[model samples]
Target: MTTADTPPRTLPSTSDNQLLADAGEGTRVEFRGLVKDYGTTRVLHGLDLDIAPGEFVSLLGPSGCGKTTALRVLAGLEAATEGSVRLGDVDVSRVPTNRRDIGMVFQSYSLFPHLRVLDNVSFGLRRRGMRKKDAARRATDALDLVGLDHLAERFPHQLSGGQQQRVALARALVTEPRVLLLDEPLSALDAKVRVQLRDEIRRIQLRLGITTVFVTHDQEEALAVSDRIAVMERGRIEQVGTPEDLYLRPASATVAAFVGVSSVVPGLAAGDRVEVWGRSLPLHTPGLNGDVEVFLRPENVLLVAPDGPSGIDATVQESTFMGNFRRTLVRTADGALVRVQHAASDHLEYAEGVRIELAVVPVAARARTATA
Candidate 1:
């Protein structure tokens, strides 16, 4: 494992300072009517999205939802069955992967086992016909951006999983590609290291102002780093919005259920409000009336006094201590189960009787007869 105490073997050259100062906004990326298929299986169905210059966007969904395929299409790794990909103002659908000028970091580190970290990062520059001395300086600068320059002399086997991933990141960025594509790059590491690297990637992307497309199934990771998230399901984008927008105002039932932990409970809808457990809460998008299923977030449900007149009587089934907060599962008298999230200090034991109520907030719901 590499340590911060290890001194960097070389100092940054004058050109390195100029390179760092020249960091500018990245190119815009657009996916227009993108579709993909493997034989008769259509993986992406007319997907469309626009990413602003230097923005960080995440394509988030479950496995086989085509998040990876979408990223690959943009990176020129896979050809779209139909439609085109635009980098800035140019259509690059027919462009080769190497000529597209895009950098990609995959789930695997994909580092050369026998090469030193410095050489591994400089390989792309060397392949592009840069002189060895120039390539080494540029590679060192890239490593410095990721705080890994001190480990340039170490081989891949001498590094930890996180360190290896960082080197892979350096390798990708050494070329200063117009866009950065990350395909669940942190998924292989342990939880703590994953978070650390995830933040590091975001930090580097911001500093370089590189337009980035990240693919991931982890909701927390997406929520923490992305400027906007496009939630995909069944080969199509279900919803696209910021993390708070998706969590608090999901455009569809699929988004509500997929983006966060929502409990689907039966409710009655009338006008702009939904009545869940005898409490009338505002609706996020008011259109449906009559019987409906409300998507209730754990944080939106609150524990009230047992004798509170507006609350429904419930029995606590379980409570999980989640550091800063506590999540407790409760079953109402009518057999509807709900999870309530509250301050960690507000502890409740198993089998304890309590009263719970939904906070007076707008909630997303769909008709009971509606399908996802």
Candidate 2:
């Protein structure tokens, strides 16, 4: 079985291990009314988010959404045009990046090409005026935490992309910063390596209990590892919630479309329910009573007999065989494309006529008159 198929390893409860014990408790991180601009263009628009101590929060959005700009402001890399960043109770908006007591890992593994892995990991500590012997010992512990102690003597070019990123991670943690910032650190690695390293990063974060802020455009990556996610669009946060909350109860149509796959079909809203494709389903949230657009998840759509008594008639357009499930796209009589997921065993060929039913689950929606 592949690593994805295997169950994740359970983390230990106690922090008696050397690396865990050294990490201590995390500090609170807050971004208050953060705003950023580049000369004439504004990138961040009065952004406000608060991350609790030791919680893993992901800033998830598409490109040009200002997620990276928010991170840079928090990191002291870019000055916020109009707000302050607080670590615990202290405002560090004016503090230099080096003095903020935070560790960061970037997309590119910015390791020293000439230095050995051990020296690369220990470089930050030595620069802080720590004795060489103590810095080396701490670096060894940090390397062991990421399971790369065996490659201490290798140079950057000698290691694989994943290993080099791990070295960067080790180097980031060696200083025991109060907060850990990850900026799409897994994007450069291959799919399998990305999964492995992301899982490893989550495991290490859990063990260390470090306050972490991860920025990623990959919804799956954010949903898989975050305690909470803040979805941003056009330099503004649309919603913030847990993975389940975001997926099941999106606040807006944009969130419904972004958090996961959703088919936007026209519907008529009554008191507490919406009628889509002749089927009445409960609304995820109340307060809509007019023509509306319903968001239907693939899993909520089911394929049934073509002659079924009550269902929408659609022609299969495409089918993709996932590991255990098959996702099929079908075009409805009204010319709307809908994606339906079903067991792999029940396959449908292209152009095959079929009837699709929406499961009686609460669905998110927005008024038809509302802006798209």
Candidate 3:
């Protein structure tokens, strides 16, 4: 509910700024051999990463990929069974959660119902022995960072779900944490609000230049806000890179399959090229191969006239109308299903049972070495 029409608010008070400076302008994070075991089940396998100061890194993967466990270890909430967590070069593997200078916000808005928004934010400062008046002023300024200063006097019950989460953010930041940990903080909000709040969180993090570690299973969300993304799987990091790196130049078959809509087309491997759909496109396979599989994105498949060009013959099965692009499903002559995407304004007029030829873009594509 925070609107742009609201008056522009200045930064927090000098006292809070001093506290942040003392904590440093974001701290570097190093996870050396980070491992976690719940009894006999090892969730993390020697995870290693070096997060630069003030960088926004997202731990992204499927549900049980140990991203959450890694975040917990960094926050000192959970100890690593084997490995060390280094924050700004100090080994804090054995440090307790309370003694660590990190702020965390979870999926649930853990707001105090008994206190007002300002008081909730200032609670940590007040507990640390700041005067009543100073804590209130600092809390107000923190709320202003998240655009919740107008609601400082309101209670948790009076705020919307998004507002309540903003209050939680203000509370975490009011103490000037060395690092901010977010565990799927926007998961509970509606789709629209989730997008809005995630954008705001990214804006605030960049504005403060604070080190942040975000854990999320949502791929789009990770791609949207992260400076880099660590794609994890089976207790280890598969690859770590920017969003474009992960999508365009996947390191392995697993990465190519997991990151986006990678559709495999039946093909024949001939040296460094693969003959897929009547086209000898550029392809690279590490080892010797005869029959192979080529992966192409939906948008990579082009639609041409069924008569003139000798492209792959397919029968249109389904067509979907997205806002900017149209998604159509087709089955090749050999009964292989392929999905194609084109601009919404100029897509193939292929309806159900309409025959068409799909031209595979002859760029660098990936192929499997062996036959299935």
Candidate 4:
């Protein structure tokens, strides 16, 4: 069995109250004609989306793309200038933030300084009028979920940044909110801790089966955790799909460049064939005759003997070995800079100013708009 299947001892029924499956077929969190404006600036432009119940979705984009605004609107923190927000069958456009029944974890650790870790986790339950003793019981369980129950007596100041963030997460989950909203919750941690906490957070979220919406500018984080990702640009959704679909078959060049490192070259499309440099290659796209740009990921390019038919004359400008892979920057005969990644094997070593060969088959080429 896969690791994702090994988490639960007893399989929970998808229809059971605990399982929290997608709200029926149409049961979803829907944004219908959503729009947000601040004076002269509009943040969301007629946005429409449906998030299935129990699904983990990430809104990924650069800053100023209105992803946060959309999250806030769903949280009832920001009023939509136009359109409605629906949570399952209920219209929550007019619901107050406290009545929305959603959990939120922010980049900033918002734990109260005077409260112990246990008290911080229990705060939301106490606010909802649970008995003090009962609230502590629920809080303790939540901390255990995050593997921080042993630190319950410590205050926020006594914990590291990652532990503090886990406390914040425990507090959010303790309320048993139907929907969870995470706003760059791992952005404050150092790089190594960020990856560790990221995995921990995913494990916990899936264990709970809560409908989650994550907003992030980090592409890796979005790709790592999301069941589906929505890429936003200029307050509009550019595309929405699984991470593999988005990475391997980006609908547009904007998405291709944004999701990962890419090397672009000019090409011409004739029928199903695309001509790049001096070669004609088959494409998945339809007929086109004008100029196009072909995007090739660094990992797809290989450096080999100059005499090979697929090889192009090149000179290595620089090289860096990153343990598992070697990154080489090569200048093609036409003076175009190309970055290639090679496996860290004995045969792949190259030094600065070394003449080399670059070869690529048509299958490795993907065309994007010249303008993108």
State every prediction's TM-score relative to the real structure. 0.91, 0.92, 0.90, 0.89
**Residue runs of model 2 more than 4 Å from their true location after superposition:** 1-17, 285-289, 347-372
Worst 10 residues of 3 by lDDT: 2-11
State candidate 2's TM-score: 0.92
Worst 10-residue stretch by lDDT in candidate 2?
358-367
lDDT of 4 by residue, 1-372 (tens): 112223433323335422223322222688999999999899999998889987889999999999999999999999999999999899999999999898999999988999999999999889889999999977887787776888999999999998999899988888878888999999998887788778777767776778889999999999999999999999999889999988887877678878877887677877777877677877654445678877878887779966776677889999988999888999988777888988878485488888888876557356765664
Candidate 3 C-alpha lDDT tens digits along 106-205: 9999999999999999999999999999999788877877778888888899999989999999899888888999999999988777887888888778
Candidate 3: list runs displaced more than 4 Å: 2-24, 368-372
lDDT of 2: 0.85
Clashing pairs in 4: none
Worst ten-residue run, lDDT, model 4?
A: 17-26
Model 1 misplaced regions, further than 4 Å: 1-19, 347-372
Q: Residue 180's C-alpha lDDT in candidate 1?
A: 94
CA lDDT, every model vs. true structure: 0.84, 0.85, 0.85, 0.82
Report the backbone clash tally of model 4.
Answer: 0
TM-score comparison, 1 vs 2, better candidate: 2
Model 3 global lDDT (CA atoms, 0 to 1): 0.85
Q: Model 2 residue 330 lDDT?
A: 85
**Model 2: per-residue Cα lDDT over 191-210, one tens digit each:** 88789779889989988989
Q: TM-score of predicted model 1?
A: 0.91
